[model samples]
Target: MWISLVYLCLYWAFFLLLGLLLVVFLAYCAYVKYIHMKYDHIPGPPRDSFILGHSSFVVKASDNYKVMHDLFLRWAEEYGPVYRTNFLHHVLLTCTSPDSIKEYLMSPTCPKDPYAYNRLFYLFGKRFLGKGLLTNPDHNQWYKQRRIMDPAFSHKYLMEMIGVFNERAEQLMEQLAEKADGKQQVSLHAAINRVTLDVITKVAFGLELGLVEGNKTAFPNAISLVLKGMIDYMKNPFMEYMPKHWSFIRQVQESADLLRKTGRKCIMQRKQAMLNGEELPKDILTKILQCAEQENGLDDEIMLDNFITFFIAGQETTANQLSFTVMELTRQPEITRRLRAELDEVIGFKRDISFDDIANLTYMTQVLKESLRIYPPAPGTSRYIKDDDVIEGIRIPGGVSVNLNTYIMGRMDKFFPDPFKFDPERFHPSAPKPYYCYFPFALGPRSCLGQVFSQLEAKVVLGKLLQRFEFELVPGQSYEIMDTGTLRPRDGVVCTLRPRETASQ
Candidate 1:
């Protein structure tokens, strides 16, 4: 009789536990359904499955991220300017309309999504760009840092750096001259990347990384490997915990450590020099140290974060922009001819390009603008919404991601008619400037601080290249855009070059 009572009690307990689980599962399903129905009014591609959502389709389309941006273009065509795509529980709203973009980006109500920016703060179990101006989500903190750094990027300061720009750009011309024999194919992208890296290191930290002089450094390859890991991490969300990827992960972490250690060493040496009562040049490093001393609660690690941040941001985007511009110029000889005509009128065999000359080369300026429109180095920006809002008659609930993509909008027919055509005239100073439809440097307060700095470097480099060499794109290479954190020509813009006089004949 005792055994029978025990078995009966156990049976009742099992059923009660099972019943509780069923109730919980039902409640979860109801919540998910509510969320789905809330976004149903916003148009998007059909969800493949409840679990994977549209990510499976996007993942299938991606090839080294060559097709990912294109997929966004296609979807934008199918579902107006605004649409929502989901990856499991994460829903991202893509806004392409000018008004929508202006409201989402320019407004103070929406803040940067920590999901995307925070990922840049750490990679492969190591910290990078920790609370730097670019990745810092706190508006107040970022504004403080920005105010301190503004003087460094002012017109007066940048004008003083033109000599450094000319010196570094000339180094590139020397390297390319060796391969300008008309038969040897050159990867302009790789060559330009080295020169730009050298420029940023010298101009910012006052360190001479002689990458352009053929002095090999592990820093370049190390930075590249770290960036490559971004794509890998995104592809396999479970990579950090997976044992198979441990080796690669370690390599990336080591590279990040090398960067931080190098930054720390350089910073300490400079600080010591200052303590010794030695006069120092008013370069970026000097400015950073001065800011550190003056600001309260700012730590050394945060200063180092800005160190790496400037190195990467100052170099990568500008290099990619120059590469894509070269690729387009090769295909559009008519445009190239027009640019050359302007270069001759303004530069006229002048090897040293001055700031005043850069401003005078109006046609060259337009070409750069058009290239950026087609292949924006940083393709898009995202924001996290905190309060429910209405945009273009659609209700956007709080706690969702909204992406503003320049690449998608730049290619759209609505904003830019015959968008694929390589026409520099569209950017002529007399022509109407693109409204909110164009924001390559982004919009409002959070826009890139290095905008003028990068563009000046680009114009200087390209003006010299056009003056010295006539480049032709090597056939049988893919012109596809590769998104390895930044968009670059897939084949690195392979081209055979001949001295300008010979090709002109």
Candidate 2:
């Protein structure tokens, strides 16, 4: 009788626990439904399934950045200027119109999404970006850190880094020349990556990556494997979440550890050199050390993170952007001709373009701007609101992620007269609307820190490349934009290069 009573109690307790869990889940679901019911009047994509929400539909079409942006475009057309989707009761609102995007970015009262960065942390944990300006919550700490780092990016200051760029650029040209020794369409993609990585290394720590010096190193292959790991993670959602468990991730992490360890040794060596009266100019590492001295010292952890972040970010964004832009120039001869004509007008054939001349080349600037607009390095930027707010008469709740689809707005007919067409003339100063529809580096407090640096590099490379090889998209090769990391080509930009001067024939 005693045993039977205890068994009954245990059975009832199990059912009771199950019942409570079901109730909580139902309550959560009901709350989500209530939010939808309350805001049902708001325009959004028709929810295919209330449980999964529009993410399912969005994920299905996210083959490319343009496709992901199309989801926003479709919703924008259906739902006024802004729309909302619930992610397990967490709201994600997509702002369709440029005005809405502008309003959100510009408003001082509004806040940047600290929560949205969790995804970034997921991509590259806190150990990589925990110390940098890019990952900082829009706050006073960011301001202080940015102030110290400002000198590093100042145009006057960065000019000293040009020797670094020139050396790497030479290596790149040499590599290409070697690859094209007899006749070969060298994987331009790999060639560009090598150049960019070389630049990042030498500029960041003054590390003479021996590739430039013709020294064979495992750094290239190791870095390639790391990049491949990242690409795989972004493609596979599970790896994105549980990064450490995946075997490839472990390999990449090991490589990253090696890089960080190498960076630390370099820093210490540089410090010793400085102490020994061997003064190096204010390269990035020098500036970072100066900041550390001012702070009395930097935590090694923070330093490592900054080193990794700067190296990865500085190289990845520009290289990807440059590669994609070059591909476009290859395809569009008319556009390419006009760009070259503009370059000729400014720099001429006999001379390498001066830095000052880079600013004056309006048409080339437009080409770059259009390239960024069409193939934004980051297709969309996400931020979660820290507090609930209202913009353009729409209410935004705290903890909701704002997916600002730069790619989508760049193609919005409401913003651009004909968003699909690529026309550099639209960027002219005399044009009726200059910034009315444009924001490539983004707007407001968290805009890209390397904007000027990137533009300078782009102009220099594009100016030089156009002056040499005339390129066109190789027949039967169509590269689709991969929406994953840095807007990469799904296959790769495969093109046949012919001399530009031979175009008249």
Candidate 3:
């Protein structure tokens, strides 16, 4: 009788637990239904599944290696400027309207979407870019750091960086000269990546990585792996838990740890140097340390956050932009000729490009602007809508992620006629400025702090390359863009470089 009673009790307990789970599932379903109803007014492509929503489309596209931005662009073209897409219960409202961009991104109140930015705080169960300026969802915390770090990118500070820029760029030119045989295929993207990594390490943290000199460091590969992990996590948040992906997840976590470890080591060295009465340059590291000191002893984790943040931000995007520019120059000989002429007239074979020379490279500036328009490395930004707002006659309900995409906007026919054309004339001085539509570095109070610094570095590197080498795209290479958290050329912009006739003149 006791054994029977025990069996009965176990059976009852199992059913009771099952009933509770059913109730919770129903509640979640109801919540999801309400969310769906809330966004019902917004038009998007037909949902592929009730549970998955547009995630199926994303997965399919990602599986085929399709550029996600291009997919978003297609949707924008089909569904008008203001439309919505669903990722499970999460509704993403994509706005390409210049007015909406001005209203939402410019406003100080609209904070970064916590769902999006918070995910970046970790990569596959490991800390990555935690509470950094880029990933910090809290506006007040971000502002404090931003305010303190502003001096690092000031005009005077940037001018001081020009010499470093030239020196590093010159190193790149020399490296390229060895490979400028016009037969040896070279990856400009890889070369530029090394130079940019070297520049940021030296200029920002006072560490000379000598990446351009073929110094073996895990940083480049580690950063790449971490970025890949970020994209993978975004595509499928549960990937880390999956048994099949454990290997990749392990590598990503190790990479994130490596980066943070490096940052910790660097910070400790700098702190020790300070204690030893050694003077440090007023670089980004100094500003970061000062910010930490001022914030009632902000922890080293936060400082490391900014350290890793600057490493990725200060290097990756700029290198991609330069690579894309070079790829375009190879395809458009006429445009390249015009750019080389501008370099000749302004710089005239001068090895060290002055800050004043950078200003006078108006044509080159236009070219760079055009490159950014076509291929912004960090394509878009997202904002969390706290209050309901009307955009383009459609009401955007609060508590959704609103995406403002430069890649989609810059390619739209309504924004730029002949949007696919590689014409620098669109950015010529006489041309009408593209109001809020041309924000490659974003816009408003929270815009990128490294915009000027990045452009300066690009000019020095690109100006020297154009002055010295005549590069041709290697045959049979696709010009497709790869979306690896950041957009870069899929083909790595391989080319054969020949010394310009007047290169030594």
TM-score of each: 0.93, 0.86, 0.96
Q: Residues 1-505, candidate 2: write the lDDT tens digits.
A: 9999999999999999999999999998899887777555556767877876765776676643434666676776677767887655656787765666776666644455665543344344424445456665556666666666677788887777666665676666655544432245655665666677777787778877766556776676666555555555544546645746667666667777676788789888888887898868667888767876786676666566667667776777777788888877765779888887887888787445566787798888888888888778766666656666675677665656687777777877777778877777777677766443466677777677778877777677667777767565556666577654466665567655655565456
Error of 1 at 86 (Å): 1.1
Best by lDDT: 3
Q: On a 0 to 100 scale, what is the lDDT of residue 279 in model 2?
A: 68
lDDT of 2: 0.68
Q: What is the C-alpha RMSD of each candidate to the true structure, in Å?
A: 3.3, 3.6, 1.8
Ranking by TM-score: 3, 1, 2
Cα displacement (angstroms), candidate 3, residue 488, comes to 0.4
lDDT of 1 by residue, 275-341 (tens): 9988887688887677767865356787788888888888989999999999988878888888889
Candidate closer to the true structure by lDDT (higher is better), 1 or 2: 1
lDDT of 2 at 333: 77
Which regions in candidate 2 have their CA more than 4 angstroms from the true location?
A: 1-17, 34-39, 63-67, 107-109, 122-126, 178-183, 211-245, 271-277, 295-299, 349-352, 386-388, 397-399, 433-436, 499-505
CA lDDT, every model vs. true structure: 0.85, 0.68, 0.89
Q: Model 3, range 199-271, lDDT digits (tens) per residue?
A: 9988899888899988999999999998888898999999877899999889989999988998899899988
